[model samples]
Target: MSIADRVRVHSVETLSDNHYTLRRATFDFRRNDGRWQRQVRESFDRGDAAAILLFDPDRRTVVLVRQFRFPAFSNGHDALLLEVPAGMLDAAAPAARIRTEVEEETGFRVSGVEPVFQAFSSPGAVTERVHCFVGRYRPADRHGPGGGHAAEGEDIEVLEPSIEDALAMLRDGGIRDSKTIMLLQHAALHLFPGAVATPGK
Candidate 1:
């Protein structure tokens, strides 16, 4: 039987609903050997998000952002994180949202974003599926000093580092954010083409 035929959802209980929604789910599943099992799981429903890596191929440089992340600090990580420009979809299309976010977060307006992939950030506990992209940019694209919106309490620092240096940061533990790392690695593989070696050998 297909997965849909083998599983059933019982009920969902909302635990919170402030910035995002949290819910506990109850379900029943059929085992491969024909036994049925029941299960309950809790998940966060912050909605999907989009992220983009902006690169200047002519100059071999990339644009990134640094912002204070309270969650990271609470979890024993350095609060300031360097990452690609990103934001929650909040009902906007992934490509459209990322284009706006790139400008709002990095001061760089980018066009012609190429979609890379979509991934779940924390599948076991969070229902956030991130849409990823890579886009081309140039120095002329800077139209403002983008530090995010003051109304949203965003104080961001834009960073432009050479592509090589970014890869080095990935290797040396300077860049620790997951989406940032994924996008940079994509740039190294497709944009730079054979510049980065595989991790083990």
Candidate 2:
């Protein structure tokens, strides 16, 4: 039987609809042993987002952004989180949205974006599938000093670090954001192979 046939949703209650929708779902699932089990779970429908790692192959550097994340700070992570340029789709195409986001957050206007993959950042609690991509940029592509929209309260700091240094940041826990880590790893393996030695086996 398909997954739709294997489970049934009893109800979904909207707990909150402020910034994003938060809902509690109650459902029944058919177990592997033929028993039916009922479960309740809460998930945040924060909308899907797209992210891109802007890289300059010639400069061997990648563009990143640093911004304060309230959730992280509330959880005791007091540092401005470093991440790839990303934003909510808001009905826009993933590719188009990310291209705009990169330009807005990093000041780089990237044209050709190579999609890497899509994945649920937190499937158990958040219904947000992040569309990831890697795009090439050049120093000439920077047209503005991107600090994000002040009206939206996005005070972003842009960073351009070498691919090697980014990998080291990944290893040393400086780059804790999941999307950034994934794209950097993709760069390490595919885009800039042999740029840096892999960790000890």
Candidate 3:
């Protein structure tokens, strides 16, 4: 049976809603064994987001950014994390949102973006789906010094690393952002074939 057919929501309680949103929901779930059980789950919803992997095919490089994330820092990652340009949609379409994010976070205003896929970063507790894409740019495409919005307290530093080095960072535990990892892997497989090899090959 489908999830909607097998479950019923009892009540939803707001746990927190100041910054993002956190809610506790109680529901009745029917198991495959034909038993119904009461369950309580908390969900964190911060809205959907969009991320783009900006690449320079001729240069074989990818544009990235380094920024401080409180969650990552609280989880023992104290240093700034490296990741592709990404931002919350906040009502904009995925492709349009990502295009703005790429320029805002990397200073490279890409003319177009080829969408790849969309995925949830953490499904168990977070209700967030990220739209992903791959866009191309050259040195001349950079029009501004991107450091994110000062009003939002975003302090971002741009980085340009070769595709080989980026994948290597994926192997070496340097790149930890989930969206960034997914985008880079997609590029390796489709954008630039043979960019990544089979493990232990």
Candidate 4:
């Protein structure tokens, strides 16, 4: 049996010379109630991927970034956030893409990056898939605490804390990125027996 959602291509409009707007035709997926519902969603219609950087089993620490987030601010809190190295996978190779994001976002060289998993970031509203991985980080070898300026208005801070400390933050509700949380908790349980979980940054 195949478990693929039925999708219909309703209409397509050109967003720009380089991009397109996909207006998907509405056909309500029948629920168990057997009622026909209709809904419409607009897809940006771009072929893009996402990237995540996992600082390897550093003697005991993970490299993270603290930055200003507009979303959290609008909701109720300040705009600053602690997050793992991450960005869109705009490159050819996912691992290499994440490695580059790590260095650019946090100024760390992620050596032996291993692909752990790939999953949907927001399947309901967006078609964004995140390539999650563990990148080996070396402090002495990596050049500096690195960051960049973007048109998107981003300010990032680099941080390195022991895994134990990161775990404490997780338990205390400091970490937030869902993908990073899943990766770090897995690492704490399997990579370091006694090490605690903590970083979303």
- 1-201: candidate 4 lDDT, tens digit per residue: 552454334454443435434445444554556664566665554444544545546477777678887767788766467777777665467776777777777767656777777878667755667777776666675776676466666678777777777777778767776776777776787667767444443
Model 3 agreement with the true structure over 97-152: per-residue lDDT tens digits: 88888888878888789988999989999999998899889999999999999899
**Model 1 poorest 10 in a row by lDDT:** 192-201
Shift in Å, residue 193, candidate 2 = 0.5
User: Model 4: how far is 46 from its true place, Å?
Assistant: 7.5
Error of 3 at 195 (Å): 1.4
- Alpha-carbon RMSD, each predicted model: 2.8, 2.3, 2.5, 4.0
Q: Against the true structure, candidate 3 has what lDDT?
A: 0.90
Please give each candidate's TM-score.
0.94, 0.95, 0.93, 0.77
lDDT, residue 16, model 3 = 97
* TM-score attained by model 1: 0.94
Residue 51 lDDT in model 1? 95
Q: Which pairs clash in the backbone of model 2? A: none
The 0-to-1 C-alpha lDDT of every candidate, in the order given, reads: 0.90, 0.91, 0.90, 0.66
Candidate 1 Cα misplacement greater than 4 A, ranges: 196-201
Say which prediction, candidate 2 or candidate 3, comes out ahead on TM-score.
2
Question: How many backbone overlaps does candidate 2 show?
Answer: 0
Task: For candidate 2, write residues 69-163 as lDDT tens digits.
Answer: 99989998889999999999999999999989888887888789988999899999999999999988889999999989989989999999889
